[model samples]
Target: MKKLLNYFFQGLLVVIPISVTIVVIYKIIFWIDGLLPFQLPVKLPGIGEVNIPGLGILTIVVGITIFGYFAKFFVANPFFLLLERLLERTPLLKIIYTSVKDLIEAFVGEKKRFNQPVLVTVNKESQVQRIGFITKNDLTEIGISNQKLAVYLPFSYGFNGQLVIVPSENVEKINASGTEMMKFVISGGVTEVD
Candidate 1:
């Protein structure tokens, strides 16, 4: 029963924030859509005229973009600082929150950590290589040798991954874009890189 309760808390820690975010975004989209006064119907190439919630969607999208700009320029820093301070007061919650936050930020934040995709030689004897992103090129700050790098090897069909410290010489930078490489890795190499 204790183990089950532990699992429940872990699930809540992961699910609640994501669920709340989705719900909030859903509410915001519909609320803004309701405020828009006009709908433009346009003729398509093949099909008849279709009513696109054109301006409402556009307004929401543009509004979100502008909001993001302002958030980055003026609001987000202080807001997140305060939020992180509050989260730090709680022990377990702080770990979960920061981990999830950093993971999200790694992909979409201003400081994208997964941009440098590379092929890591995991087993030299078998000539086995794994696709990963170089998250930290210099691990010296963490007392790791500067000759090693931190590579994040994403698992197939999952958001979770393993981080490995490999010698810089064994890491080969790939020509593919981050998104393409991520897609290929997540699809278990089934997806073609374009």
Candidate 2:
């Protein structure tokens, strides 16, 4: 009976999060579609107000396609360039646009490379070691060179931690992938790879 209860609880843990995530995504898409100027009037035979199946996804696809088309052509065009310059001059909108553009570029840009994970000693004793990801190597004109590493110290069932930057020499490269490290972190070091 105890074993069955444990399994049921574990199942609920997985299923609840998945269902919640799907519902949240659906609601967001529905809200965005509501804001659009036009929408398909044809409703499904069974579902009265749900519109067509996967219409939200279709709307997103169409919106992205239109945006891409406009960006490719209009961005370089003289008239559009003038409008863009005018918009950029606006203080409030410019700040918002610049911040959003930077965030988007960071996520989707080809030049962006993520920190590589390595093993580092955490506490006073070298015996206590933790996993860290190398952010970058900073070469300053002050004749001081330093390597930045982000260490994720996991706590509880989820990651509620800070990223610590340590020197390069303090860390040792582990022959493990990011996925394996994530699993280890999520399970609070209970999950180990042979």
Q: Identify the candidate with maximal TM-score.
A: 1
Please provide, for model 1 over 1-194, each residue's C-alpha lDDT reduced to its tens digit, 9 standing for 90 to 100: 99999999999999997999999777876676677776556799899887654457777789889988887787558777787798977899989988888888998998799999999999999999999999988888999999999999999989889999999999999998999999999989988889
Name the lDDT value of residue 127 in candidate 2.
72
- Compared with the true structure, what per-residue lDDT tens digits does model 2 show for residues 96-138? 8776765465336543323355777776565788765554455
Query: What local lDDT does model 1 show for residue 66?
Result: 96
What number of backbone clashes does candidate 2 have, counting pairs of residues 3 or more apart or in separate chains?
0
* TM-score per model over all chains: 0.61, 0.55
Model 1 C-alpha lDDT versus the unseen true structure: 0.88
lDDT computed for candidate 2: 0.67
* Per-model C-alpha RMSD: 14.5, 5.4
In model 1, which regions exceed 4 Å deviation?
Answer: 1-70, 73-80
Off by over 4 Å in 2: 43-50, 53-57, 111-194
Give all candidates' CA lDDT scores. 0.88, 0.67
- Distance from true location, Cα of 102 in model 2, Å: 0.7
